[model samples]
Target: MIKQTQKINFGKRSGLEVYPVSMGAMRFPEMDKAIPLIRQAIDAGMVYIDTSRGYGDSEIKLGKALKDGYREKVILSTKCSPWVFKAEDTDDSSADCTYKRILESMRRLDVEYLDFYQVWNINSPENYEKATCKGGMVDGIRRAVDEGLVGHIGFTTHDEPENISRYIDEADWCEVILLTYNIFNQKYKDVVAKAHEKGIGTIIMNPACGGMLAENSPVIADAVKSAVGISDAVEAGHRYLKSDPNVDTIICGITKPEDIESTIANFKKPAFDAAQISAIEKAMNKLSPDNAKVCTSCKYCMPCPAGIDIPAMMDVVFHDKVLKVPGIAKEKYDWLTGENNKNASKKPSECTACKECEAKCTQNIPIAAEMAYLARREEQSWK
Candidate 1:
C-alpha cells in the first residue's frame, strides 16, 4: 500500500485536495486490459485522472473503468478544442462549438459532469484572445458551469516559455493550467511558480518527455543512482519532477501495472535535497555531447511527409550510440518497421532528405542527415 506522498489544495477557492501525481490515460494499449491498471493507480492514491478528446478511445476506456463507484473517487480532467472556424461566421457559433465539444466529451466518458474541462492546446496569445472573446469559448464554459456540466475552467498549452508567462498572467478565471515540463526543459519553472502564486493549480505533462527519460537513459540513471542511492532511473526522473514545490501534480502516461508500482515506489522516497539535486545535475551534464542532439521524443516535429517516426528512429540511434544497447535499438527499429506499427513501416531508410522535419524542430536538429546516418548504420549492422 502506498501512503499519500503529498496532496495539494487545488485552486484557491475550489477547496479540492488533489494528489501531486496524476494518472495519464493517453498511452493505453487496450481498454479491457487498461481498466485494471487504472484501478491499481487509484488504489495507490493517484486519483486525479487526466484524458482528452485526442487520446484515441481513451475517454471510452476511462468511462468503462470508472463504473461501479470509481468515478466519484477521482478528479476527472478532459480537454477539447474550442475553435469552430467556419467560412461564414454566426454570432452564437463559437459558444455552440465549445458547448457541443463539452457535451461530446461527457457522452464519450459516460459521465454526467466533468470535474475539470480544459480548452486544449492554447498555444499563443491569439488563441487565448479568440477563446475568451465575447460570445466565444469562455461563454460556452460559463454556460456549462451554470448548467452543472463542468465544475471548473482550465487550459493546456505547448506555447513558448515567454508565452506560458503570458497565459498565466492573463488567466483570470482559470482554475488549472496544464503545460509541458520536465527535467530536460526547466524553462517552465518560473512560469509555473507564477501560476502557483496566482492560486491557479498547475499540472505538468511530459515529465518524462514521452518516455525519453525513462528509457535507456544512462546519464540520468547514473546521476540518480549517485545522488539518491536509487538504482532505478525512471524513479529518479519522477522524483526530480516531484521535488519542485510549484508542481502541484505531474501527469505520467502509465501503460502497465509495473509503471504504477514503480511510481509508487519512487514517491515513497522524500523529495530530493539541494545537495542531491546539485549532484544529479552535475552527473547529467557529463553525458555525451551528441546525446543532446538525440530526439527528445516530444514529437513536436511530427506529421512527416514521408511518414517516418523521426523521434522513434532517433531514440534507436541514442540507444545504439550512447546507451551501448545495439540489440535493443535494432529490435525497436524492427518494431517501427513492422506491419502493426500505427505510423506504418516508416523506416529512416525511407527519408528523402527533404529537410521539412528539421524546420519544425525546436532543437534545430539536422533530421535529414540523422535519418540518413541511422539508415546506413542499421543496414551495415543487419548485413
Candidate 2:
C-alpha cells in the first residue's frame, strides 16, 4: 500500500481537539507537581492524556487534574498488560486480577470510558502467542471495547525496527501505535509508514530519548535552536519528530510545569528545515555514545516474572559495557534485581520457562533469555 500522506489537517480525535503535542505523566513530579503540569499541557490545547495503571500514581494524579469537566476536553488513554489473557482461564487473569487496577484508574481519573485503551508494551520476543493467542491479552482489549469501557483500541511497543514491523502487521486491529520512535531509531519508519497506510494513529515516546538529548547535545541542540527558534535542547528533539507528517502526537514525560511550557512553546516554533534534520541527527550521534542503544534505564519492560527490572538490568549491562553511567548502574543492579525485594516478591532468579512478559514487548527483545543471562552473571560475580 502506498503510504498515506493525508496529513492531520485537524488537531482532534475521538471527540477531543488538541495541539499536536500530548502530555505523558509517567515520572515523578515533585511535591504536588503532577497536576499543575498536566493542567498546563491541557491548557496549551493538548487534548490527549496518556497514563497507565502501572505508572506510579499517574492515573490518579491525572484524575485529580482532569476533574471539574476537565475530562470533557481530551482523549484519555491507558494500557492493560497482555499477560492476563486465556480462554478457559477466563475466571482469572493478570488483567482481571488487576481489573481493579483499571477500575481504580478510571475512578481516580473520573472517566466512564477511555478514548483509547492500549496494550502497554509489546516488546517481548514471544510476540503474538502471548498477546493474540486464544488466551492472550489482546482478547481482553477486544472484550474491554465490547464492554464499552473504552472507545478505541491501540497499543505501544518498544521493539526493534524489524520486529516492530512484524508486530504492527500482526496487530492490524490496533488503532494507535505508541512507539519509542525517533530520528535516532531508523527501524520504526517502515512500521510507521504501514500505520499511516492503515489510518491508525501514531504516538511517539522518548522523543527526547530519556532526557539524554538535552543541552549536552550541543550540535543537534544548536541546529534545533536555529531551526525552531527554541533555546532548550529537549524542545529541539520534540520539533524534529513533529515535522514528520505521519506522527499524530508526541507523548512527552513531563516532570515539571516548566517542561510543559518548554514543550508547548516548541510546538509554536517553526517546522524543521533540511539543515535541521541533518544537524539534529549529527548532534545526537556526536553527543550520544557510539551505541546509544545501550540501556536507557527506561523501565518500559517491567513486571518481570523473575523479578528482573529489564530496563534497569539492561542499564547495568549497558553502563558497565556501554555508556558507563558510573557506579549507579552497579548500585541499581544490586538494589533492583537483588535480594532487596526477595522477601516481598520473587526476584530475577525466579524466571519460569513460561516467558509471558517476553511476548508483549514492543522492542521485540529477548527478555526471558536476557534475565537468564543476568542471573547467571550474578552468581558468577558473587553479588
Candidate 3:
C-alpha cells in the first residue's frame, strides 16, 4: 500500500491541492479491469483523475469505476472536443453545443460536478480560434461553472510552444493547463514555466513520451544511473519530470495493476537534487542534438491516409541512430514489416509523400523525407 504524502498546491490560481503524480485514463483496459485499477490508484494516493470525451467509452467506464463512494476521493477532470462539433456542423461551435457536450459527459461519467473541465485538443492556431471564438467551447464551459457544474476551466494543447504561449497569454479564463512534457522532449519547458509564473496549474501529460522512454535503451539508462543511481529508464524519466518545481503534477497513462504499482513506487523515491537533475539533463543533451529529431511516438501524426505506421518507422530510425543499436533497429523494422504481425498494414516502401503526416507531427519532423530514406535503406538490405 502506498502511504499518503503531503499534497502540493496545484497552483495559486487553480485553488486546488493534489499529489504530485496523477493517473490519465486514456489507456485503461476493459470495464472489469478498469474499475479495480481506478480504485487502486485512488487508494494508493493518486487522487487526480483525468479523462476525455474523445477517449472511446472511457467516460462510461470511469463512471462505473467511480461508484461505491470512490468519486469523493479524487479530483475529476474531462475535456470537450471542439472538432467533434465541427464534424457534425460548423454551427456546433456555439456555447449551446459545448454546454450540451458537458452535460453528456456528466451523464456518462455519472458525476454531478467536475473539478476541472478543459477545451480539448487546441492543436493549431485555427483550433485555438475555434475554441475561443464568440460563444464557443470556452464560453460553454464557463456556463457550466456558473451553474456549479465545474470547479475550474482550462485547455489542453498539442500546438507549438509559441502558440501555446499565445494561448496562455490570451486565455484569461484558463485556471489550469495540460500539455506534453517529457525526457525526450523539453521544447515545452519554457512554456510550462511561463504558465507557472502566471499562477495557472500545470499538469504534464506524456511524461514517458508515450512509452518511448520506457523502452530498453542502455544508453539513456546508463546516463541516468551515472547521474542519479536510478537505472530504470521509465523511473528515470518520471524523476526527471518530477524534478521541475514549476510542474504541479504529471499524468501518467496506467493500463494495469502493475503499472500503478510501479508508478507509485517511482514517485515515492526521493526526488533528485538540483545538481543531480542538472547532471542527467546535461547527459541527455549530449545524446541528442535537438529534440525535433526525437519522436515521442505520441502518434498525433497517425492514421496516415496511405495507411503507414509512421511511429514504428520512426522508432526504427531512433533505435538505429540515437540509441546506437543497429541490431535492435533491424529487428524492429522486421517486426513492423513482417507478414505475421496482423497490424502491419503498410510498410515504409508504400509511403507516397502525401505530407499529411508531416503536418500533424508535434515534433515537426520531416516525415516524408524520413520515409523515403527508410524505403531506400530497405532496398539496400539495410546497409
Candidate 4:
C-alpha cells in the first residue's frame, strides 16, 4: 500500500489521474487465476493498467479481471502492433487495420473506451514514418479519438536514445510515451526529462532491466539492501526507479497476488537519499568490468539458431568477469545450459559463431564473440 500519495496527472495534454505505479498486465495467468492478482493491484491503489495485443492473452485476461466493476477503477492502456500496419498493402489498408484493431481490442477488453492506445514497438526510422504518414495508423488513431473510442494517443518504443528524443520532440500529438528505463541504462534520462519538459507524461518499462536487477547477484543485492536498509532485491530495484524525479510512473508485470502486494509495499518504501544512491552507483561501476560491453539483457537478440540462451549467457559474463563472482556465475551458467532449466536446451558452447544475434542487437554488441568468450571461460573454470 503506497501511503505517500504519489500520483501523476497523466496526459496533461490529453486527462487521467494516474498513479505513480501502473500495473503491466503482460504476465498474468488464465482468467480464474489472474483475477485475484488484478484485484489485489486495484486494492493497492494502482489505478493504471498497461497491456498489449501482442502480449498473447494479456488484453483478454485483463478484460475478464476488470469485470465486476473493476473497469471503473483503472485507466486502460493497450498497444496496436506494428505488424498490423506493416502487412497493409496501402496506407488506407493500414488505416483500416488500425481502426479494426482498436475496435477488436475494445471488444476483447469489454470496454466502451480506452484511456490510452499506443503504437507498439517503434524501433526504427521507418516505423516513425509509417506511424505519422497520411492515412496511416496515426490518422486512424485520431479518428478513434474523434469517435470517443480512445482518450489519447501514445507510443511504446525500444529505440536508441537519439531516436527516442527525436520521437518525443516530434510527437506533439502524443500525450504519453512508454519506454525502457532502469539502473543500468540511464542514457534515456535526458529524453525522459525532455518529454516532461514538453508536458508529455512518461511511463517506465523494464525498470528491472529484463529482470537483471531482480537477480540474486551477491554484490548488487548486498549494496542495494544496505543502501535502502531492506533485504528484498526486487523492492530495492523498484525503489531505485521510484527515486528518479523524472519518472512519472513505473509499469511492472505482476504474475501473482503476492507480487502486487510486494510491488505496492516496495513503492511505498522511501526513495534512497542522494549519498546512498551515489554509493550504490559507485559500487555498481566499480564491480562491473570496464572491458565488457554492458548488456541490458533486453533479449532482442533471441531465438538463436543454435538455441543458445544469449541473454542469460551474457549475464554469466557480467557475474563471472565483471562482478568477479565465479561461483554464482557458474551456478547460473550450468543451470541455463543443463536440462534443469526447461527453456535452455543448448549451451553457450553450442554457439555456431553465426552473426545473426549481433545483427539484431540494439546496443550493437558483438554477441557471437561474447558467446565465444563465455565458452572459453567455461572450459577453463572447474572451480
lDDT tens digits, residues 217-270, model 1? 565566668777887766766788778888888886888877777776776677
The stretch of ten residues in a row with the least summed lDDT in candidate 4 is: 84-93
User: Which portions of model 3 show Cα errors greater than 4 Å?
Assistant: 84-91, 289-316, 319-321, 324-347, 351-383
Task: Please give, for residues 1-383, the per-residue lDDT of candidate 2 as tens digits.
Answer: 11112225322333233457777868847537767667767767666778887676777788788877788877788875634232233434344533444565678677898887776677775754566667456666666677888787777887777787777677666777788777556457677777766667778887776565552544444645654466676666777777777777788777766667667667666768877777666655543433464444445556766555566666556544444333444555677744634434344567775666557555556766666766676677733
Which one is best on TM-score? Answer: 3
Estimate the Cα RMSD of every predicted model relative to the unseen true structure: 5.9, 9.8, 6.6, 6.5
Query: Per-residue lDDT of 16-66 in model 3, one digit per residue for the tens?
Result: 898888989888998888899889888877898888887888889889999
Decreasing lDDT order of the candidates:
3, 1, 4, 2
Clashes of each: 0, 18, 0, 0
Clashing pairs in 1: none
lDDT of each: 0.78, 0.64, 0.83, 0.77
**Model 2, stretches more than 4 Å misplaced?**
1-18, 28-31, 82-101, 125-127, 215-232, 286-383
lDDT of 1: 0.78
Give each model a TM-score: 0.78, 0.68, 0.80, 0.78
Backbone clashes in model 4: 0
